[model samples]
Target: MASTRTTRLDRKQVIDTALRLLNEVGLEGLTLRAIAAELNVKAPALYWHFKDKQALLDEMATEMMRRMGWPSEDQSADWREVITAAMQGLRAHLLRYRDGARVYSGTHFTDTSYAGPMETFLARLTTQGFTPAAAVRGWHTAYSYTIGYLIEEQAMTGRTFDLTARAERLADHPLAAQAGEEMFGDYDAGFDRGLRAVVEGIGATLRAPGAPGKGRGEARA
Candidate 1:
């Protein structure tokens, strides 16, 4: 991998180098030592900015979110559009690098960059009258689904599911054989449909009888 710039290294520069190298070496190959070598500094230099490799990864994930450009108040359209667009952006960002989903899975960012976008997402829902608890659940639903789905998507990138081949061996099973179309459908469409379902379910909850029911039929209608 290419070594970093000769200028004084900072947190952002280090992470930029790490992500560049990530595209080349992948998640498994990303390490503090490797990053230091790229920056042409001793490994200990990284500790000044990041406590450890996980901390660095958190920043990397944060930077990726920043670049996705979180929604603004004016950017708000319908609630469903808000939720689906956020989910889709996250999924696309995670797919930008190899194993990015796995890399971002457990990392937490303690900085403003992550906070701003997250706040933007939750605020969009709250302004529509979603209760705090409901807003959180909606965020979790979409975020968790994006992360989990992308993890599998990244894993299955070069491999084939080929349920058809397995079905041939079990030819007696009619259901398995009949599922060929279902098994090999458009992945992007399937993911969008799943995200839409989650958003729709959250909307349903708001619309249930005796609920605050804000942004339900009103915005959707």
Candidate 2:
């Protein structure tokens, strides 16, 4: 019962179909068979494009990066500004699909399309007095925070919570109730504040005595 259109199926076609199906079925329900059905192809036809579910996910993450566009080539901005913008943009893109953060985490990219932009970003950091290793670490920290935040955020989506009721129920545990209240308030402002702390923490590391460049503007005269 395969459609004639199935014969024209390509990798992009498969990945695109998978992404579309992702929002509908989410990461747990999205399977090669589902994508194949959506594309009007047999499950085997999908295997021809992706060897397995993980392979498809890897490529899907790659496609997500492509859609996210790249950091600007302009290096005039401070490294902290660059990290904030990039992480915030990543959060927005991950919010676009159900389980998007899950799909992106722990998946290897299937292509080198990310390399050029990453190189540019690293170069920007180095010019701002980050050692190559420090630049890599800083980026990883920010990336980890963004991914972790979205994972929790997506998991909580559409779930009705009665924070006040919970707090009253936990009135015996005053600190726990207060913590829960704080955790549920204004995720946007919380994310911004947390990201600022991350950037500032990294900046502190770089400025510590004996650190590379010693200071942001002190990069090897």
Candidate 3:
């Protein structure tokens, strides 16, 4: 039931406009009105496509997932490599936009097309003898780690990483002063280390006795 003016704008156009607004003003400031203004259309024009801001947000999240494209077919790679690539791909994709991870984390997509990437990756774990429950938990843990890391990474974008600044104010705080360098040095390396731990921990569970979907006595006693 779109008017002539509204009919001119397709759903994809509206979503693109909204994403541009999101980059300019961020998630907190991204309003339907703002998107409308960017599109040079009335807010009601957008209503023809999106019922509300949440709908718009959901599309945006789905669009980002789509934009990531399907995962590559690395036939020789093990489950760990595949899982690592998927997690790191998500983190990299989320970092592309301002407040990308936050926007992605907060919304639920109506698009089920994301299942292509998701199911394939989960199948990899399941093939390695992981129960559905264990696979889901492991996937969630890796995803949560990526989201949390990206949130912290995005939050630190504009801040200076000077340990000396901390040294001036927190000189009396011995532990903070001692660990400031460790805290700020090489976020990329820190993230990789954490990612390895997550992958390794998931693998450990697969090898642990009493883990679901394993042969009896398959692992250590």
lDDT (CA) for every model shown? Answer: 0.77, 0.84, 0.79
Give me the runs in candidate 3 sitting further than 4 Å from their true place: 1-7, 74-76, 206-221
Tens digit of lDDT per residue, candidate 3, span 1-221? Answer: 54335448899998887777777788899999888877778889889888998899899998888888557764334667777888888888888888998888878987798887778777777766677778788888899999989988888877888888887788888887877766567778878889999988888775345434433334422
How many residue pairs clash in each candidate at the backbone level? Answer: 0, 0, 0
Instruction: Kindly provide the TM-score of model 1 when superposed on the true structure, using C-alpha atoms.
Output: 0.81
Name the Cα RMSD for model 1: 3.5
- Root-mean-square deviation per candidate: 3.5, 3.1, 4.9
Clashing pairs in 3: none
Q: Model 2, stretches more than 4 Å misplaced?
A: 1-6, 207-221
lDDT of 1 at 154: 81
Encode model 1's per-residue lDDT on 29-132: one tens digit a residue: 99999989887888888898999888888898877767775556543466677888878888887788888898888877656767666777777777666777
Q: If scored against the real structure, what TM-score would every candidate get?
A: 0.81, 0.90, 0.85
Ordered by TM-score, highest first, the candidates read 2, 3, 1
Candidate 1: lDDT of 180? 59
Candidate 3: minimum summed lDDT over ten consecutive residues — where? 212-221
